[model samples]
Target: MPTHQIQIWFTCTVDDFSSSTLAQTFSTINENIQQVLNPLDAICHKPREDAICVSQLRNAKKVDEAILQERPDVKIFLPFRFLFWKPQDLFRPNTYNRFLAATGGDHVISLIDEISFRFPPSPPLSQIDDLPQELFCNGDNRPADCGPNCECVHQVDIPLNAIVEVVLVDEVQSPNLSHPFHLHGYSFNVVGIGRSPDQNVKKINLKHALDLDRRGLLHREFNLPPSKDTIAVPNNGYVIFRFRADNPGYWIFHCHFLFHIVIGMDLLFHVGTQHDLPPVPPNFPKCGHHLPPITFDSGYH
Candidate 1:
């Protein structure tokens, strides 16, 4: 007989389960099976009373204490920062700049430079004498379907069979939520996932990560990275993935959440020129606008 090793993982408040018949059943099962507790699995109300407390993960008291110890001058404004705390605050460019300044991070850029750097036009690929002219639609020059009003259609043109590395930094809109980003064309290798080493820093923003990367503090597991098509980026951390742009076509990479995609949390990867792609099938359906032009008659019918 094959012995089975069972483990029960609780993701919600166990107190809610304790008063029910299910709790009794679980209690009986606990005698034989192992029960694992992970505070990061769920959000708890009255964490101190709960068996799995999230205090260690998101303790505002600790953050305040750290801030007071590091920068005594900002002690007066701590209450103000907390009083008007908003989720969108985390995404502001100034928030990153402030964090970099506070942490003594060298890799700091101005708000305008950061915006331009992050959302720059697609770069031209290295010239190849044998290859034909490149063809693709990117942010700098979008297709007709992507009109002046279409702010969501961000695109990047990639050379055929080029090695690409993508580092996704979670802005931490919500500490509990993780965005599962999915790429349509290719499955990439997830090489690394980590945050700042400093225990005092509760959250790791993009600037912090870039600074660490610049200083060679971050490590990549190039030898044995797991290949995945979709990856759930950690909250307040970063995920590094790499893949080859072997497929030649327009592919979408976006957050798995339908609502997030609707609101423009997506981008396109245009790989290779149109000549690199295979011929379309005879009955391949057409896409984009195909409205018939209207002609006004001089005489009434």
Candidate 2:
């Protein structure tokens, strides 16, 4: 396979942040990319002429002009402070003249701090166009979206055996926070993490090569399969994982972060199998009924 050129483009100040956290995060991402995209040269932090690094938005015009100036190739990772601009002042419906004016609606990855909501508050256009069908609706069971008090489930009646691949991202989402995401009756393999944001190639993988490289920097050879109830994702960096579906039901894959699930992270994996569901219990509440837990963590509440 040809070496894929994925740029880990992020902007940070030399003044504020220390170099250590950056190093550790970068190392984690480097090892992760090396493991997953084997025989592929994953460039983490390459300073190319094409890459755009913006710090202050002098005005909306400058932001627009600069973004248009540097036609980014793929993932555009925006910094945190950038999103602080008021939506009313910028990116309005009438002018429709904000950052969206610059680029095509390609895959843009924003560096959002998961713990806080810094991005703009607006419903995605699709929802505004038309409300989607209610597959399953428990009185606000959607994690993260709904506060801790709500317990809701929107049943899609999705069959099993449909999903061919699943990637679990550690960090951003961990097992302990809200809903313990459980894939009923099937298991998946864990892929490695993405490119490191700090360190360059040789230095980062050298450490993993010392420990995880049983066959010389090949991590899959040293990967440990799952044998636990809840999978714990890393905190700082993200994880790339894979899984398959063989079971036949409306399976639930949610964040173990209880509040996270309650918000909107909980999703249904409908494996498409051609089989009838087993008989319901004697006192089943309803087809899509949700039995409220006696005591759930108040993280979302």
Candidate 3:
């Protein structure tokens, strides 16, 4: 029997080996197998020469190469290797535009943190009126204070069968924390992720992202974007994703962190109207308190 030769590629950062023994072992392994100290160096380190132009807009000019070169290095957190370091910027969108021209969206939705609405000064509850009580009820019963004017629920209604584009921005206050946002029913294509190139912009928020979009600085990769149900919104940055809303029902989109979700770092995406949903099954199990009225028997002692 003949043995087949196998090639191994080890990838890591310079900071991976903290202990001398581990570093020596890695060095020994490198002598026998090829190693990649930093994989992103090949992909993102070099300056992009091609101009990024948006096709959806008529006669859109290509974005300057000089501006694209200013994007920050893509950082990542290896939880098993480096557990103590701050959360890092793991990914960024492709430098040039692709595929989006062919797959244009029907609706654009903005996902923002409390900072956008000034939640700390004003409560984090939903201020929008006429929200359905069934949607805002805590468990099966509505809170005593909650009424037709839902003060406890925050949600966005999405039309059925529409292609939806979401612009998710990081909170200005927690610039160092990466939020892992998850949508319940459908996975989305993460087409873009980036921060403002301007050094003067200390924090990137929804408004900053809008301004960048207006200036044609935010690029979207519609061609072969990774489909994900959950994605980490880069620390101090923003992420743009798109999905087709064919599902007709209520869905929650929220931060994966339990504490964050508890504190209202989430919202409901009411996809389509109640009419779009299938009829409830007859005699289906229901939620709510059910109790027979109790009466003291006269003969009871």
lDDT of 1 at 136: 33
Q: What is the lDDT of candidate 2?
A: 0.31
TM-score of each: 0.50, 0.33, 0.51
TM-score of 1: 0.50
Clashes within 3 Å, all models in order:
0, 38, 0
Q: Write the number of the candidate with greater TM-score, choosing between 2 and 3.
A: 3
Whole-model lDDT per candidate: 0.48, 0.31, 0.47
Q: How accurate is candidate 1 locally (lDDT)?
A: 0.48
Write one digit per residue (lDDT tens) for candidate 3, span 1-301: 0011111112335766569746555454424444332121112212243321111111122332221232322211111000111112112353221111112331111123321000122211221233344334331234565422223455566788666777776653343466778999997665666666767998666677778877877766544454568876666666666677778776777778664454445666667877787666677544422457978889988
Candidate 2 stretches greater than 4 Å from native: 1-163, 170-182, 191-224, 273-276, 279-301
Candidate no. 2 TM-score: 0.33
For 1-301, candidate 1 gives per-residue lDDT tens digits of 0011111232234555566746654654534433222233323222332333211122211121222121122100000001112335535664432212213332222111011112223322222222223233333554456422233235567788766767777664355777777999897765556555666777666566677777866545543344568876656666666677779886777778664454445666778887897666677544433458977688956
- On a 0 to 100 scale, what is the lDDT of residue 227 in model 1? 59
Clashing pairs in 3: none
